[model samples]
Target: MSTTTVTSTPNPSVFGQSVTYTATVTGITAGTPPWGDVTFVIAGGPTIGPVTLTQTGVDSGTASVTDSSLAVGSHLVTANFVNSSDPLDNSSGTTIQLVNQAATTTTVTFVPPAPVCGETVTLTAHVAAVPPGSGVPTGTVTFIISADGPTVTGTLDPSGNASVTVPALSVGTHQVAAFYNGDANFAASNSPLTPLAINPASSTTTLTTSPPRRSAVSR
Candidate 1:
């Protein structure tokens, strides 16, 4: 009979982060290294196929696989080892893996960076996962303009960008920021205050014509 043990690196991993699962087989007779394959079965996760085991020692063998698409939750990871020779019996082992939500950063920007009063502008928010984490963040981003100013919310697109159009702003300086409402796989975040200035609209003057021309011609 053979004994199998399973283990995972970075047991507590962030969503979208890569994790490696390894299976070690032992309890082999003297001078006869174990030979066969090992397969990984994960609950609520993808199943990894039969990876041929390699003899790491005189009486032990090892197999490993790496995966990066696990969901954000606890998973029951199992390793099943199959022995090619009839003399040995197949064995299995189990382990636990925890995946947490990834952190995110939010940034806000507006079109017509330098704008004049009475000119419409479009505000955009971008949300991205922190380093070591990958994949676009989903959900809504709420935009606020100055204290007690106008507020709007926009949904995230495939590229993690949300945009909303606002009417002309008053001529002055205003603080703008974006707040990202996180999804199941990512954490919420707020952007730093972005200062914006709106210049005063230009003015135009018109002249009026009088009847003096007609009086001069008569004289």
Candidate 2:
């Protein structure tokens, strides 16, 4: 009888990264060599060739394969070893691998970086998935003004952008930022703080004094 064990270099692999799977075969019979080929298969994915197993000791051999094109999700990997001399002693083992989605980033911008008091300003947030992964960001983005000011939420559009208009803000320099509540495909992210200066509104006054001196002179 023979026992087969399988393992992956990167158990929790990321999308688009190569993962090496190694299988070790050991024979129960003392002093007997376990010479043969090992085949690897990924459920719902690709299958690797029957690579020749290299003898390491009197009763053990090993085989390996590298795969780089697996979808992002959970998958089952199996390794099978069959020796021609010991057909009845063939063995196989299974393991699970988790492939996670790539990371994402968030950026924010104000239509007018600076604005005066009581002026409307538009705040926009753009969310995108990092390279190695491609998709439009979905979900809601919350825009905040200053540290303890008003907060508003907006849903992402098809272009991965969300915007909200602030009716008015107090006079002073305020910090603006946006937070993206991630969806199923992407992770949550926060944008850097943006400095906004709101200057006080300007006003003008005029006064007119009638020609009282001319009326006194005429009397």
- Write down the TM-score for model 1: 0.92
Provide the global lDDT of candidate 1 against the true structure. Answer: 0.90
In candidate 2, what are the lDDT values of residues 175-215, reduced to their tens digit? 98899998765678989997878889888899988765554
Kindly list the per-residue Cα lDDT of model 1 for residues 1-219, writing each as its tens digit: 888999999889998999999999985577677888899999988899799998899889899999989889999999999898853579999999999999999999989999898998899999999966778999999999995459999999999999999888888998999999999999999999999888999999999997765545654
lDDT of 2 at 92: 94
| C-alpha lDDT values of all predictions | 0.90, 0.84
Each candidate: RMSD to true structure?
2.3, 5.7
What ranges in model 2 sit over 4 Å off? Answer: 1-11, 15-72, 77-95, 207-209, 213-219
Model 1 residue 160 lDDT score: 97
Off by over 4 Å in 1: 209-219
